[model samples]
Target: MTSLRHNMAYLLTITILIVSVGRLGDTTGRRRLLLIGILLFTLACILCGLAPTLWTLIAARALQGLGAAIMMALTMAFVGETVPRARIGSAMGLLGTMSAIGTALGPSLGGALITGFGWPAIFLVNAPLGVLTFALAYRNLPADSSGEKTDRAGFDIAGTLLLALTLSAYALAMTIGHGRFGPLNVALLLAAAVGTGLFVFVEARTASPLIRLAAFRNPVMSASLAMNALVSTVMMATLVVAPFYLSRALGLDQALVGIVMSIGPVISTLSGVPAGRLVDRLGAPFVIIVGLAAMAAGSIALTVFPGIAGYVAAIAILTPGYQLFQAANNTTVMMDVRPQQRGVISGMLNLSRNLGLITGASVMGAVFALASAASDIAMARPEAVASGMRTTFAVAAALIAAALAIAAQTYRRRRAADPR
Candidate 1:
């Protein structure tokens, strides 16, 4: 899970950058960049499959992240530009559903492939899919004609460096915390804090910021971003700790753990389409608030119960909310921004979610560490772990509640601003 998270962190970062860059490219050149990104992603997958060591794999993953970022950014921008405003809600819902499906299936598929073959199969599977996607994207996507040149002056290297440094430092802290870092961990944490502060400062000052600070002028966008980050944090925390609780606390075997874990994604897939449809009729704000409320309820339930059955039930309850929130939020953010800025906006949103995930995971790990320290796992047994997990869940629930409040404010503000 740690390895996957690390890879995804880079992947998401790169995907955002490439796509945003592609968006700025000459309108006619955007499709070409998308194609190139697809090709690079495919090649990166091959490289990842053949990687000889962990370091090599990480490098390959970084390359793949770049490709994925490009595709995601450009695709989001394209949807905003090509789809009509009225239909965009539906389109975003569909897109969100598809993403949910991929996420849902990914674990099961990867597990099966790993069981049947080896870890390499996990990546090799993407080779064929990538080829098929490229072929279709090339044949179907129209050539861009927006006539916008790549904004050479728009790239904020200082901001990008600061952002990357902050994320990397956080990732390092999480990955290395399990070891006997002692006081070194404190130093790293401090460094991360300093880096984050610098990033905020640089972003505020950069002439053409990588992430448009001006976007926050829109209350809806600002609130939505905040809500997205918190929601992501809660979701990631649950994802990280749930399996541990099931396998360690409940004494479930690996197979049962997998089965129990499938519940959330299954529910998410089932709910995504319906949520999307609801968003279209009710608007994204309404859907998002409902989703956040559901997630909060689910997380709280998990915290209170701390039993296998309860956890499963909580996941079932929580999954739909998350799916809905994702679908609605995507639509809300994309529609809120102008067509030309969609790529950068999309990148920023993705970055927010990724950063949230990293932060959540690190904090949860700390929770686990503190819990384990309080009671020796071997002596106190799984109850101590359960206690720790419960605390984490409670924190997650609180964060989700905060997200719900933000979502409510966003909706109210947007409605007031556009009182049509």
Candidate 2:
């Protein structure tokens, strides 16, 4: 129940908030929304920390997701609005680096808190940070939502419903496939397929879709969003599975595993700034291709070499690529859209990435379960689990390759359309 709540609640809340913030873009000022989001998120975190019941915890998490969505959507739009186009890439890179640092720190911090105190400590620690963020936002953020005439299009209620159904079905399938559910797993998978079909149908007909179908008409934006999904999936899979491999297969202690996992984010943080500079100079497409290629190489290397040494090496190789790809992708997406529509575009990009993470986690968990059941594979036999990890990486690589192909096609189409 906890697992279900955590996964579904986070996914649903994030998706809803993204769509809501996008719709509210024209109605509310960006800075105002951002500040409000920060406050809501902080409050939600506090609620999560204090909640005594499972349902309460889920509700808190949902609220946190909403707040996070608001902040994220506006942050992207805010950057696009305030920063010069020429320097947007650099700004995005720096933002990516900060994100990498936070991600890198989270596991270690959470673990430490859990070990030192308990599970609740993990949620509780957010309070101080939330306060700090709120203070910063209140003081620094401007009050600017002024722009062109608002898009008076009606809300895409059908699209939103379909999207929620699709995500819920996918999450249910993953949990069931992982053996968390019994006979209901197959039903969940069927539901996912149905929901996805409905989503496609809704998207095709919606006059003002939650996800702007026409924006995808731009090859660059489409390819970037697609590749973002693929790369994000691979990255998430690696993060989820790596610690288990280290602790069970390699005979490493949990503390050591935590340290090893931190390496990737550290590398990512270091690489992000430079990648941003590169994007500014070379263009988003070029940077994205290079980043994707590097990530692919890293993933392939992990598949080939699944031991502790190999894992560390993979982190070294992949982290920078991941950071580069993220920074470049954000720049690409922001540049592709107009300022007024930045909120919606940002929400879409985030939605794609979050969806990818959910998919990867669910699929990879099932892979692990199957592999474990087939063999006497304890976490101690890292090589035994290596096969499963390898499969996951290989699949990720394939996805990245597909993304690369799409990106190439997008570049060609854009060049053909505008010779500027």
Candidate 3:
């Protein structure tokens, strides 16, 4: 329970505040807000390191999430400000590479820090790095346009509150049950539904909205967001299910499972730059389909093949495809966003991805447990685990196929409209 709280605290905070902070950046200044976020994150790291109680650490982690939300929201928006329009894919790819590297390194680094120094060392180690990041960003990030402040509309405080509530309720609904959806989950879901309706109603009436309702009218943007969510859900299934498959189905111990799990992030890290360059050369629309196709193939491999070799092959195929899709999808959405709307749109992108992840962890885990026919997955038989693995990947494949169809449809629409 403590571990779960620790993990969820950060995720919940980030999911709730990400969009609001991004919008705030647009009004105040992305660079200024980003610098403040970095400073806050640095302080949160120190607080975490010195925390004497588990609750305090959790609180500090939430603070870290706020900082992370600001950074994540602005960083992509920065691509538009700093990079040339032609190299947008490359910039997105580099961001993806950095993210992949962090994901790959986090586990090993955290484990080593715990072993060598203590739990606090993991948090404390970031202090210096955070400072260095702050310095670099302050020195290099461009100043906000003078007009950004002059022409900005008032920040939508009411809309921000409603959206945050809606997201928080939904995230809790997905996460609180631990695979079993009971009354609490149902109630939370209902609350989320109501909140969503209220948010739309308010946004439609407000002079300055958190998300301009008309933004969703863009078929490309809407399709891209939907595809992003679906792809993220499928990608997350690998993270949630593969560990159990490795340990129970294949009878690998913890160490072997960790090594096997590392392969995905390693592959993702290696593929990020190449995937970005592919998008640059071939264009985002074409590369999006290619990435989805590769993912579908990878999912099928996981469903049909059993054993370490097959598992590795599936991950090797799936991971790079994810990087490809991420780079292309992000580029597609951000490439043409107006300067004023860039921050909010970037936040929406991250919001979709994060929501997908939360859903996958809950929904995919439920699917795996149900398919395995085991009340307790930890004690499930090898055959049962294998069955669950196959079923989960089958569902994953179906999700990817859906994403592929969306990509194809979006591409067709774009071609029809531009025909050049």
Which candidate leads the pack in TM-score? 3
Q: Higher lDDT: candidate 1 or 2?
A: 2
Clashes of 1: 6
lDDT for each residue of candidate 1 in 1-420, tens digit (9 for 90 to 100) = 647655655644562354245434433356777898899889989998998988788888888888887787677766777787766667776777787788779988998999999999999999999999999999988776545445655667777667666666665665565533557677777888999788778888877776666787887788877887888888887777777778778888988988888777777767777887887888888888888888888888887865777888888888888878887888888885765577677767776786677677777666765765554443435777788787887888889888887887767776888898
Each model's backbone clash number: 6, 5, 0
Task: For each candidate in the order shown, give its overall lDDT on alpha carbons.
Answer: 0.75, 0.77, 0.93
Q: Which candidate order results from sorting by TM-score in descending order?
A: 3, 2, 1
Residue 402, candidate 3: Cα error in Å is 0.9
Q: What TM-score goes with each of the models?
A: 0.88, 0.89, 0.99
lDDT of 1 at 189: 74
The regions of model 1 sitting more than 4 angstroms off are 1-29, 52-54, 178-183, 192-207, 369-380
- lDDT by residue for model 2 over 1-420, one digit each (tens)? 686766578667886558558656644567777888888888888888888899999998898888888988888887887788999899999999889889888877877898999887887788898889888877876666445335545667778777777776666666554535556877877888998788878888887776766776776777777888888778878877787777876778977987888888888888889989999999887787888888888888988875778988977888888877887889988875776677788888888887788667777656665664544445335556666677767777888888878777877876788788
lDDT of 1: 0.75
Q: In candidate 2, where is summed lDDT lowest over 10 consecutive residues?
A: 372-381
| All models, RMSD in angstroms | 3.1, 2.8, 0.9
Pairs clashing within candidate 1: 11-65, 15-68, 15-69, 15-70, 16-69, 19-70
Question: What ranges in model 3 sit over 4 Å off?
Answer: 151-153
- Predict model 3's lDDT versus the native: 0.93
